[model samples]
Target: MDTPSSSPYGTYVIAVRGFVAPFEIGVYAHEHGRRQRLRIDLRLTVRRTAPRFTDDVATVLSYEGLVAALETLSEGPHIQLLESLADRIGDLCLSDPRVVEAEVSIEKPHVFPQIDAAGVTIAYRR
Candidate 1:
């Protein structure tokens, strides 16, 4: 599964899964200037900066900060593709020095009738 416990680069993991938010993205004419729900899944392998984990928030990545950044990004300038969205997410995750690797996936679930969703997955390592 390539988890933090299995990977030599990190000691723990922080993840956001099944996060859905309204986003302005897509290439088709019908999608222009429109908002749609995007399902986001992210995983980050992080290393401990302290000798022992403590109650201090500084000891680990701030979950609130990550979620706030993501929500702000969703409300920011329009993006054209799911790949771009996923890549941006990867960049956000990799910004934290503790994060050794990041995997981001974005899906547009209601775009088509036949399929559940259309999306892209991206991975980045530091």
Candidate 2:
């Protein structure tokens, strides 16, 4: 039998993926698309005890909260660069008490003039 003190490595990672947002991202007039879709994937490192011991969703960071924050930011002004967006998302993720780190990826599909897919990825930790 394993006691709580002697349990296996303990930590929780929650992932929020496929978040689509529209932005005016480009460098030139002709390069502009109707609306650029940004897909953001977030991985959050959280404390393991809250959900495991208490079994209460409120005791841990809510994925919905994270998504809402991202959505709110996405509705703002046009982001000229995906790197900036990724950084902001990462910062937001780490703002939660339960989150120890975050990995953010923002992708702009069909943005490139010639390429099929083009995007940017970024990572951050607390």
Candidate 3:
């Protein structure tokens, strides 16, 4: 029979995809005073502290908490670069001790009509 003790390592992922937020950020004059919609995609790779499936919210990384944190970040002062925004998100995800890695991507869809989107992707590992 398979037992929890036989294989102790476990991992899980918490992700927020296509989370759109209006951000007042850009270096261009046209992007100056108004808020532009930014789509945020985040993935967190987490190592389980315990082997068993406790089925409890407290024992797992809560996407709700992450979303709340992201909301807070979006409400902050105007940002100058998409890279900066991605770094801030990486910091927030990696704050949890169990998080092994964080991958963040932010896209500006309306910046141009020729392409789908334009932005940056950043990854943080520990």
**lDDT, candidate 1, 98-117, per-residue tens:** 78888898889967799999
lDDT of 3 by residue, 1-126 (tens): 643223246677888998998998999888778888899999988887786769999888899998899889888888889999998899999998888889999999968879989999999987
**What residue runs in model 1 are displaced by over 4 Å at the alpha carbon?**
1-10
Candidate 3, poorest ten consecutive residues by summed lDDT: 1-10
Q: Could you tell me every candidate's TM-score relative to the true structure?
A: 0.88, 0.79, 0.90
Candidate 3: residue 27 Cα off by (Å): 0.6
After superposition, which runs of candidate 2 have C-alpha atoms over 4 Å from their true positions? 1-9, 30-34, 49-51
Top of the candidates by lDDT: 3
Q: What is the lDDT of candidate 3?
A: 0.86
Candidate with top TM-score is 3
lDDT of each: 0.83, 0.72, 0.86
RMSD to native, candidate 2: 5.0
Residue pair clashes in candidate 3? none
Error of 2 at 14 (Å): 0.4
